[model samples]
Structure formats: structure tokens, C-alpha cells
Target: MHVSEHIIDIRYAETDQMGVVYHANYVIWLELGRTKLIEDLGLSYIQMEQDGIVSPVLDLQVTYRKAMRYGEKAIVKTWIEAVNPLRVVYGYEILNEKGELCITASTTNILVKKDTFRPVSFKKLYPDWYEIYVREQKNENIN
Candidate 1:
């Protein structure tokens, strides 16, 4: 499986009244991690948009496993959990400075026409991406 790591320095503004990281901020971190994974695969969302294709989140699921405080670093590990022609599932694990998992999440996204918001197939529009994701997904399943 292909995993991409992005480090985020916990900022004070990202914290809540309890002095731990805010829950909603984790969603943004997931997006950053997903983007990094796509870039690591040599695919650019910007380029896709220029081609009139836009990938939007169909659904998101996140679990808060632990609390994170400021002055700590967040290590976001992202990988392709599953993939299909029409949709992809990206998994994420956010760890604190000690490598303890703080969050576990997944987001399902689909490629759509930016103008009409109609579904499109990565297999048809970007076969290379589909093939790469297939390999990644297979690797994940093997382990």
C-alpha cells in the first residue's frame, strides 16, 4: 500500500476551550492528507479541475481516539483504502508527537463534472489513476 505522510504543527488557534485540538479542525487535516496522497501519486487536483473534473467528498467518517494539545506535531498518514471507477475511499490516521493515534477516519469521494455535478468514472477519464489506485488497494487488502 502507498502511504503519504504530512506533518502539521498544532496551532493554538486549532485548540478548544479544553486545551485540546478542536474536532472540526481534524476534518481540514484530513483534506490536507488526502491532497498530499494525491500529489504523491503524481496526480494534481488542480489539473483535474482545469480539465473540468472535480472530485467531491460523498461522505466522511472520523473517530477521535485521543486528545492533542498545542506545541505538539500531528503526523497524518493517508492511503487508499479502496477504489472503484466512480468513487475512492481514502483512509487517515493522525498521530501525536508520541506516535499515539489521535484520529482515525475515511472519506469517500467521487469524480464529477464541475459544471453539472454529474458523476464521472476515473477508469474512463483517467485510467492511469484508476490503475494506480487498484494496485494500492490490492496491497492494502493483502496485508
Candidate 2:
């Protein structure tokens, strides 16, 4: 599978009043991981936008397993879970410095026309990129 790892150093500002990383910060980390994954695959979100295609999140699911505090680092492991003509599902695992999993999540994104905001099939618009995702999804399943 095409897996990408992104490391995030928990900042003081990301912590809550109790000193644990805020719940919402995980969402940002997810985005970071996703961005890294896309870049690792040799694609650019900026290029997608410049081409008048936008991918918006259709669904998000996150499960917090362990608490992480500031001064620690988080390793986000991301990969493609599934991909089709219209949607791509990305999976993630956030692990603490000690390598314990702190969160598990997935996000589904749909591509659309930037101007009209109408849904579009990624396979039709970007067949090469779509094929890469399909290959990754197959590798993920095999693992």
C-alpha cells in the first residue's frame, strides 16, 4: 500500500486547559497526514484546484483512543482505504511518541467542478491519479 507518515510535534497551543492535546487538533493532524500522502503520490492539491477541480470531504470518522500531551510527538500513518470513480476513502492512525496508537480515523472525499460545485467522477477527470489510487487500494486490501 502507498503509506505516508507525517510527524507532528504537539505544541503548547494545541493543548487544552488540562494539558492534553485538544480533541479538535486531531482533525488538523488528519489533514496534514492526508496532504503528505497526496504529495507522496506525486500529486498536488494546488494543481487540482488550479485545474478547476475540488475535492471536498463527504464524511469523517475519528475514534480517540489515548490522550496525548504537549512535548510529545505524534506520528500519523496514512494510506488509501478505497477509491472509486467518484470518491476516495483515506485511512489514518495517529501514534504517540511511544508508538501507541492514539487515534484511528478515515475520511471520504468527493471531487466536484470548482465553478459549478457539481459532483464529478475523478476517473473521468484524472484517470492517471485515479489509477494510482486504485492500485494503492488493491495493495491495501492485500495487506
Q: Indicate which candidate wins on lDDT.
A: 2
What's each prediction's TM-score? 0.94, 0.94
User: What's the lDDT of the predicted structure labeled candidate 2?
Assistant: 0.92
> How many clashes in each candidate?
0, 0
Where in model 1 is the C-alpha error above 4 Å? Answer: 138-143
Please identify model 2 stretches exceeding 4 Å from their true place.
138-143
In candidate 1 the C-alpha lDDT for residue 31 amounts to 93
Prediction 1 TM-score vs. true: 0.94
lDDT of 1 by residue, 21-106 (tens): 99999999999999999899888889999999999999999999999999999999999998877888898999998999999999
lDDT of 2 by residue, 1-143 (tens): 87899999999999999999999999999999999999999999999999998988989999999999999999999999988788899999999989999999999899999999999989999999999899888343311
